[model samples]
Target: MSDQSLLRERWLPGVRELSFGGDYNPEQWPREVWAQDLDLMRRAGVNLVSIGIFSWGLLEPRPGEFDFGWLDEVIEGLHAAGIRVDLGTPTTVPPQWFWQQNPHVRPVMRDGTVLAPGSRGICCPSSPEYAEASLRITTQLAERYGKHPAVALWHVHNEYGAPVSECYCEVSAAAFRAWLQARYGTLDALNTAWGTTFWGQTYGDWSQVGAPAQSASMSNPAHRLDFARFSSDELLGCFTRERDVLHEMSPGVPVTTNFMATNCPSMDLWKWSREVDVVANDHYLTAADPRSQVGLALDADLTRSLADGRPWMLMEHSSSAVNWQPRNLAKRPGELARNSLSHLARGADAILFFQWRASRRGAEKFHSAMLPHAGENSRVFREVTELGATLWSLTDVLSSRVQAPVAILWDWESLWAQDLDWRPSVDLEPRRQVREYYERLWHDKVTVDFAHPTADLSRYAVVLAPASYLLTGEAAANLTAYVEAGGHLVVGPFSGVVDQDDAVHPGGWNGVLRDLLQVSVEEVLPLPENAGVTLTGGTRAGVWAEDLAPQDAETVLEYTDGPAAGRPAVTRRALGGGTATYVSTVLDHHALTAVLDPVLERAGVTIDRDLPWDLEIVSRHGADGSEYVFAINHAGAPVDLPVEGVDLLTGEPCTGSTKIPAGAVRVFRR
Candidate 1:
């Protein structure tokens, strides 16, 4: 089958409209309340709901004992109400009885402190006992509900490797040793790859190799990086075991695990995306930052790209405010619809919340839900119903795909290596640098898709790689070949400095891609926290400055006056049939705009129109050759959008310029 067909089969099968609703915890309330929830769900247009995510204790109550009585009623009630179900495997939160019996299965921190059992995801991924118990529960659930008409998808586990990403116990160490042995057959090969000869830490036997735990000083960087990879793999192993059980018992039912947006540092989602049948993500706004919801859009866009730009599911997001942040603030009048529509505009076929009903008591009692604490009379519920109707009106846009001409490079190894100690500047975080470039493109109204280092670049016009710290030979060659084959490549500062083993290149920094960019770094000048310098074109540079010289490239921007005056801040070179641009410092917003504008123009990237910072536009091409333009206003004031098309929501012709209200969405079909 084709990729589009696979996406529809896994995510959009049997759903004529976009799937809605979220975690519906009927166990949290009495049986009488279930009927009320079904009524409210229908009134709110909720078609699907995720059930039994953390009900392991309630489902099993004792070792080797199971009870499916309550869940049977819950599923039957929902199915009778015409609501499909995403049945969770209930493995994230192991039951209290199992943990009390097998206490060794609990996770141990790097500091050797065992985590308590009060929170979710406290079980160790490497524990065989934990895996056995989890599989037992999974098999029972799948066998009982496999043939049920309500069952649509299998949720393996909730947010794998969140707080319990790494464990320092002996089981984890043994697993790490086994993983390393599988990667490198002999100890000599392992020692060479880890660069253990430098620190006189070479090991003689596999038993001597262990996880990098707390010590008086910093541990080996390569060891830590490998341990991180092992932990993520272990978690994936647990998920796959449960998934296998479900697939054996229930044929033809797609499986998925909800991914937390960009927040999961341990698991490499790029690898995990291939394991599941469909991609689903959970996202919440950074309420403390108070920025526009554009950052949330960034998360959705990255998730969609992870699924190869096919439509995915927005599994969980708060209707208003989340309770976990330092300060939880409610959303304004139209911010809810704006946030939901932004995700759909990118590539989401479903938009759901963290919960359907508010919690009466728990850690997340204050977290907003579709049915707020005030019940149906609340503003949150009003917006929820309105957004449901609006979403239902866009049924024609289902199975559409996003087309992006620009791609951003996201390397998990680079992120892991960049966070290690003894960097040039602490401000040079990989995510921060990538976000800087992404926000610049967002303000320019340029749609972008994220690509891994090894992803095919034949379709993208421009590829921006920021902080390419850990450059493998293969990755370096892949990037160089792209530029040589007529693709515009932009390299950020501090890139190409180190190899995969955390070892610096022999020559100057950025030596690997030096020939491609035609530039060499003489020395790195770390500016003061608040210091900045300007280039000849009035472009500003801050955080870091590199003393660079052009070998075969021409200097595009040079510093005017500073400690490193008359030095090149940005350089450009023309290769085979394309151009390569190298940025030597962290550029401010104006400077980033100044740098990207010409590159985008040269690449023939389309912006649709010059949009204000508060307005955003994203287009989708339908399977039947129709075009959809989703224009959203994130600002608080009215703005005139210089685009016209047929309004799909109202069937009105929008001509010349269209005025968009604050936090409103306009869907145009052209």
Candidate 2:
């Protein structure tokens, strides 16, 4: 066992603390409101909850009937109130008598309609009767809560490719032609990697391959990027077939599922973060983006870089305003402890939420919870009982980690082949160009993570990419062996321009990092809708541009007015002692902080250049050589925060300058 004892037996088994509660339906109130929802979840400092996700029609009310008597009295009253469960597996809402006995296991749209089952991720992840009734209700909830003692953590299916990810059924077109004959083992290599001899749409059997369904015009950007990689590996084979039946009926519990990470752009969370066992997520607050806290610190540093930096799980969020946006905005008083201490300063050793009393009915009765509806005398249960007494005084940040010298690549099949549908700018959004370079390295407090461009970037000292439009030749030789072992890369616009089968890159436009970006692209000029451009150091740029020739690099910004006017709009090259650069357009954020402040001072990196673009900070450390930090502040007044010591949320002390008020959050401990 040791992957640190299976990550503390799947998320602190014998509690190292910090798991706060939420999502506890308690069969939508009744049995004396489950002892006043366990005395308002122990007066709001709840400790892990997520019970029976959307309770499969009151836990099987027919069809092989079963009912765990009100989930064994709400997991024996949340294990007599010391709380802790994260149990779920309600198979993301399946029971309308198993959708009226499998009405073709629902989900079909790619213009083929069908989707009807009353919401909550309606089935068909390549349905074989939804893989035998979602592994028989996940082997009857892992043989009834696999040795339950308030079952510490299983939470199997809740947010898998949300609201149905891909299912243009004919049983998902014969399971996407048996996942394209196990990934192109010939229909002439799936008609030459779906180029299909340019739209005559060559298939010659594999039952005329389908699922990029309903298309009279646009349906073969390599067959819609391999049906978005076979609908994200058939919803990660329905979450590893219920995470391998909750690891053979719960042999050491710890299963996990949740991960709407960049808000569900259909799974492929680096292949579902190697089939779970902790790496949770959920994040909300796009409440009309006034920089939703920089997309909640870029989804908590891409869910703690998909748990490679360990300490994951902020399982869900919203202790205020979140009833499916379009004008639902609340969390204003210290914005839910600065969005739960910005997901516990980017490593999240458990924070949980999505509920824990508040719903008086269904369809997420006004989403935000943590005992709200004026319950524990509300104000979101007094900032969730003061962020649960500041996460039970951070049990020394349980297995602390978050230390990033900057990294960013993040692939999801190069953002599903740069969100396929005629690229070259529909405002070429690769998640808004990696959230505008992670909100300019999170307003320069600079602590990022994200990797996966062929992993190991010898511990990042500057790496960027920004929106890698599918660059694969072994991630361009692991980024030209991380710029020939010196790092500092960058890239940006229409990056390495396509491979890994979306085609293109065969001598021309960044053919796999033209010799680690000595530059090439002689065409792609995008910008139009309300245009923009300027460059030659006056910066400005917009949507895109390219022309760029510089065969030996060094230009670093040129254009000077729209359609590649004077050409090269940013380059660099260097090589052996690290350098690359690139970026052809789309700059703004003070022109990407004046092209990353001299490449972060030629890769020495360290920033905090008198931080306070609404203060943020970060830190973490701890496997003995302690640290902690945090800060937060999200503006409206006071700031300062140079950081020194003590303050674990007001046990004060912190000299070396601290202050931090208006929309507060501190932490410290250094």
Per residue, candidate 1 scores C-alpha lDDT tens digits across 454-564 of 789879999998778888778878888888888898999999888877888766788888878889988888888888988878878888888997899999899897767
Q: Each prediction's Cα lDDT score?
A: 0.87, 0.81
On residues 1-670, what C-alpha lDDT tens digit does candidate 2 reach at each position? 6443474444557777777877777777779878977886787678778888778677777765778888987888788888888788887788887778788778878888888888887777877776787787778878877888778788887888787788887888888888789887779988887678885888788887877877777778888888888888888888888887777777676787889888888777987887787788888888878878998898889888888888888888888978877799787776887888788888888888887777877767887788878778767788888888888887787778888988888888878887777676677777888898888878888898988899898888899987888888998899888988998888888887788888988878778888788788878888888688988767686877888788898887788777778787888988888888988788888888888889888999877667678788888998789898888888889977666789875687877886788788778777
RMSD (Å) per prediction: 1.6, 18.4
Please estimate how well model 2 matches the true structure, expressed as its whole-model Cα lDDT.
Answer: 0.81
For model 1, what is the C-alpha lDDT against the true structure? 0.87
Stretches of model 1 off by over 4 angstroms after superposition: 1-10
lDDT of 2 at 234: 86
Identify the leading candidate in terms of TM-score.
1
Candidate 2 similarity to native, TM-score: 0.41
| Residue 151 CA displacement from its true place in model 2, Å | 17
